[model samples]
Target: MKKYLIVGCGFSGAVVAEQLTKNENCKILVIDERSHIGGNCYSERDPNTNVMVHKYGPHIFNTSNKKVWDYINQFCEMMPFVNRVKTVYDGQIFSMPINLHTINQFFNKNFNPKEAEEFIEKQADKSISEPKNFEEQALKFIGKDLYQAFFYGYTKKQWGCEPKDLPASILKRLPVRFNYEDNYYSNIYQGIPRNGYTEIFRKMLSHPNIEIKLQTKFNESFNIDNFEHIYYTGPIDAFFNYKYGRLGYRTVYFERGEEIGDFQGNAVINYAEENVPYTRVHEHKHFTPWENHEKTIYFKEFSKETGNNDEPYYPKRLEEDLYKLELYLKEVEELKRYTFLGRLATYRYLNMDQVIEEALKIINE
Candidate 1:
């Protein structure tokens, strides 16, 4: 039987390892620098509150892919979840994604669905035949005041770049509703895995042919050349030894505090004001809304430039990163025996469902 090396035990690696082991006669060696599985989405029972907390940050599983949903469901039961996000601007609370009710309430109008749609259109920049950038894109569709109120400051803080510098593609298809629906995602299939994500990792790697090495770093002595292929889920630039400059990534920091009662009314709350240092606050207990908790664990998320010590969270794929990425691609083509997988390897922001779906495609290929 042939053997393959899977580097990084993220969802991408886990799904691929499981599928390849079942579909082909391949022995798998899964490795991760982290002590546990599930990558950034790793969850465990919070010692403080006895609730399964999102370790690095909150990861809500929202995707419309049925196959991807079904595939994960086989490993662990999924509890229904709707990501109801809130936002605080100028010390006032509002539903995020700027839904119909938000519009009416913000403007102090009593518009219904039809009136709300017309109102948004009136607010939109009708003269803009084409949107030049992220700012223009939002203004063209949603109007200037709304953009200023909801997006402008928040985006500048989150990305550390003017929305005008960003590609209009970034704002494409941001969830906005004509109705009062504030569920962050409109996916037909949405939920949190019943057990923590670690349990899901356990099921994915349960096959006899798989060997997992946690806290193991891959060096020349690892003998990856002996294997038929290498599945790399680590950062693309790091994989090639930064042969091509470096791809930029935004690292995040979280400040936590225990709240005896509800910290915030929702699971995710966006701090849209630029004055606010942190981007969002996550109320962990609200994640498992099926069960209630007396105490809540919350995180105030702050983003920073990624360093060697800091774990890469969000890929800052600007024009400069794209230039570096081209060089990385050339280097990837020069490699001997490896296949890049997932958002990290590809340097794209991908959701959990997309990762699972992509892994299935890779296995079939």
Candidate 2:
């Protein structure tokens, strides 16, 4: 029998398994080094609260693709969700993305849309005519007060590099608003899977042609020989044995706590102040607002450096890392019958829906 192997059970791996299984001649076996599937978007029930908690972190499905949303609907119903994020700094909670309301609250002034626009113009750092780095870009756009409060410290702690060391592309992700809107994202579709993310992955790979092996790590020498083709979702640089040296990345350490009721009454709370140890806190119950849970679960997420030993999460795409990735590109070109996918594989951060959508496209291609 012709056999196929998937190195990881993430959405990327699952989508490939699903598409390959459609062929009656192929037998696909999926493997996840972790004891479970669903990659970082994995969700399960909390023993005490019975709420679906995102194991690695909160993974919201948000995208503009109707086809991707419809594809997800086949496995599970998605509850409508809006990512209303808040930023806590100087012991005050304000709306995120720095809208007109945020400006009013932060400055202690009642500035409507027109006034807010003028106020921001006055506050913007005029010294930075052409901003060179993350710090300069933020300062140029929002001025010292807003940049310091919302970005300066949080960004420094997150990347362990000064704002000058980082590129301006990071600050470009932040949206500036002249209106009172505070929604974190402008995406059309946003939601949490009604039955949890793991259930969706489970259903996606449940076909008889697919065999999932949990807690089974991939050993290329022995395992790769057994399968004719390989779809490796593990780290791309790691696959090349770190010949040009390991790529730099950031890993999040989550501290879970039991809450009697609600913690922040929001899904995500970003702590922009440098004094705070953790960057942001996620209230799991807030993710599923459709159902109310008496108890809540919250996570205090902290950033750490990703090395050869640590499980790579957020790829630190700076000068040095990109140079190393160029070397990885060479290694990938040298290979045959192997495709890398997902955050670990491509070395980039992505939301759950984006991961699924990208994987589907890869499979279709």
Candidate 3:
């Protein structure tokens, strides 16, 4: 029989624990500092409205990988969901991802798909053969007008840095559509768990050979010799006691309030103006369209540089941070009986499906 200690009971840890438990000789222990199972993906019913509220933020399960989708579906029922995000700029609402409808509406011109594509190509900066930064990428892709309206302000607020300062890779994640298709993601499968993400995690860890310890923090006090292997899903820098200083990260603060009926008639609305304090507002009730509620709960998301006391959300993997990360990786290689899992452990921004896929790969290896 073998014993494993899995730190941080998030999707990565839970998935690994579930896979390991398939072997009768394997026993697993999962621990999390937060008194919940799903990590940042944790969701629960709002006491007042009885609507499922995404505690940290809204996490819509979307992935093109059928294997990942089928693996997760085994634990919980997934309701079909389409994320149609909207952006507010200059007191006007527009469809996000710069679709053809958005272009026609924004410029007050009726242009078909081919016309729109040609227009954008002319607007793009043809002189720049290669985009070296985020600003250059935007200007090269859709020109200045579209970039300023949708990307500039929103990206500045979201990353707490100017677009020019960020990497070109950041803008590559976004798409420019020539049609009216406004679905936020191009994934083949997209949905939300019917019972909430917390339930999914609960079911994943229900095996007889698994033990869960909530509110338990992994620190120096825990003896490493006790377990055959350690699966750490926390911050890699923190695990080594900040021997090479902490890696940079951007954390979000949510300003929550309850309102009668729908707040914005949409799941998410982005405030694409730098003057506005918060980056976006999330209407939680709209997230779970299967259920209805009289009162709605929403959150005004504010992003800032993470501090020692704050929980790190998005990894700010700038050039300096990558240098620090490399140092941490060297230390990781020297260690024994330990494996890093998930976003924080690897210090990379990964979606839920990617995290699960990585977990499954590691366990199979």
Candidate 4:
């Protein structure tokens, strides 16, 4: 019988394991450092409120690819959801993604779509023919006022640096809309699973050929000679024991609370002001509006530099980080028995659909 080992049982590892099980006379072992199967996308019902709380943070599955969409739906029923995000800036609530409604509210003008476009053109920095960084990109696209109100403080808090220090490509895609459309994501399919994300992972890893171990951390000393091949979804830097220095990452910690009736009355609300501290407050109950609950649970999420003990969330991918990543890739190329996959392994910020697509491609190859 063929044997395989998978480290970190997130979507990437779980999808690969499930696909591999179709092979005859094969057995797979999956392990995660965390006690749970679903990595950051883990969700469970609160015993007190019976609300499905997004333990790591809210994850709404959205993808433009029909193949990816259908692939995930095989595990669980996806409740139709459209994320209409809201932001609080200067003591006012406005629709997010800086739509025409947000534009009118911020400028205090009732300009039509065409007039709004013209006004934004005038507001944009005319001197900047090419944006050099994130700050310049925002100013060129939405002007100083909108940039200051929406992108400036939030970007600083989330990334742990000034927007100017970041790369221009981060904001390359235009973030504003000329119409009143405020759907946070422009994906063709968007929803939260009816049975929660954990169930989806549970179903995927339940194949008879697969065995799982929780709280099992993999390191260089772990025995790998027994397995035919190994799929690692953990951080690439940690795999090399930080020999080239740790790649920069920003991690998030949450302050959770429970309230009766409703807390924010919405799934997510961004606190755009730097003075507010927390980047966003998410009420988990609002995520599943199809279910009724008297009490709601909310989390105040704060971003900071990832420490040794922290679970790294977002990859900073600064210039120095990229240099270190290149070195790690070189070392990875020399290893024939190990394959690195997923967000932390690749050191790239990927959506759920993108991660699944990458995992499927690897199995196909």
- Judging by lDDT against the true structure, name the best candidate: 4
lDDT of 2 by residue, 1-365 (tens): 77988999888898788878775478998988898998887899999998889998878888888998888888888898888889989988988888988999899999778988899889888888888888889888888898888888998889988888888876666688978777777888888888899998988898988898899877646447768888888888778777888888888888989979988888899999898889999998888888889999899999989755666777878889899998898878877888888878888877767777887887778
**Residue 224 displacement (Å), model 3:** 2.2
Name the lDDT of candidate 2: 0.85
lDDT of each: 0.87, 0.85, 0.92, 0.93
Which of the predicted structures, 2 or 3, would earn the higher lDDT when compared with the native?
3
In model 4, what is the error at residue 272, expressed in angstroms? 0.6
Stretches of candidate 4 above 4 Å error? none
Residue range 1-365, candidate 4, lDDT tens digits: 88999999899999999999965579999999999999998989899999998899889999999989999999999999989899999999999989999999999999999999999999999898899999999898889999999999999999989999998978868778899999999999999999899999999998888999999989977888889999999999999999999999999999989988998888999999999999999998888989999888899999999999999998988899999999999999999998999999999999999999999999999
Q: Could you list the CA RMSD of all candidates, in the order they appear?
A: 1.4, 1.7, 0.9, 0.9
Question: Candidate 4, overall lDDT?
Answer: 0.93
Model 3 ranges with Cα > 4 A deviation = none
True lDDT of residue 313, candidate 4: 92
* TM-score of each candidate structure, all chains considered together: 0.96, 0.95, 0.98, 0.99
Q: Considering lDDT, which of the candidate structures 2 and 4 is the better prediction for this target?
A: 4
Clash pairs (backbone) in predicted model 3: none
Q: Model 1 off-target regions past 4 Å?
A: none
Give the Cα error of residue 269 in candidate 1, in Å: 1.2
**CA displacement after TM-score superposition, residue 350 of candidate 2 (Å):** 2.3
* Lowest summed lDDT window (length 10), candidate 1: 217-226
